[model samples]
Target: MPQATKSKDGCINQLKIAENHLSGNYQEKRESYDKEEQLMIYLSKGHSPNDKYESYDEILMPIGALLNNTLNYQEKNEVIKEYGLDDEEFKERMRDMCNLGEALELEARQEESKRKDVEHVRNIIDEFHCSLEKAMDILKLTEKERQEIMPYFQA
Candidate 1:
């Protein structure tokens, strides 16, 4: 079997494992071909070969679109041909892109969390008239975080 097929199979197996952990109808039904087909077509509409995604959401949306197609036997082959890549090569490239996307998402989440933490620390200082050290200790903030939030308090 092709590596793409193997990967798809692996993904399915993992999904099955996930389903086992769920308690309800959230487990996907293999018999729901019509619903699955509709979902595939709907997802594919977001991915035109010539279009470029501009924002973070635009970039992230296509990963689901690509993944929906990538798991299908015919669609995956078509995608490989569309990219002019061999099976193994496309697989490697897809893996790299997925990793990069995941890293970017992680960084974005961490930044947002840090911003919220800084705001919370500032609130603690303002509401209680506490020292910066006290706020830092309460929030478990690091020296770097203290330096970053200090300027806002100064102004």
Candidate 2:
């Protein structure tokens, strides 16, 4: 079975319990569940199947604890059964999820770097009071790269 379907159901089933535990739904609190679910779905879709979990109880424990604490033991067991991964399989899935997190963080870092580069160029234009062409030349940006960053600088 696809992880997304299982995770979506798991999230929908467990979110209410988590929310209830956290108490009165403030904006950030309410948004966390949606954000978490979206992240799970995004990771599930991106994860490669070949990745295996080697960490045993270390990696899986937090997941099991979250389920057990929020959803309760009986519900947690039922959910595990419904998802149908045995111990080894469940571990592998957990590892894949961890990889998804690493992948997302890497992507975010790369994007942040690109954003900084754009800001540097924008700063050159504003603080130095230079034209875009001059800024591009000063930054040593290729025409294509300059064009790509131009949309962010529109008046």
Root-mean-square deviation per candidate: 15.4, 14.1
Evaluate model 2: give its TM-score: 0.41
Number of the top TM-score candidate? 1
Question: lDDT of model 1 at residue 7?
Answer: 23
Segments of candidate 1 deviating more than 4 angstroms: 1-86, 147-154
lDDT of 2 by residue, 30-115 (tens): 65565443223112332222332334333343344323222333444444454454476665665555556567779999779678
Q: Each model's TM-score, in the order given?
A: 0.44, 0.41
Compared with the true structure, all predictions reach lDDT values of 0.55, 0.53
| Cα displacement (Å) at residue 100, model 2 | 1.2
lDDT of 1 at 149: 75
- Each prediction's number of clashing residue pairs: 0, 0
Give the C-alpha miss distance for residue 5 in model 1, angstroms. Answer: 29
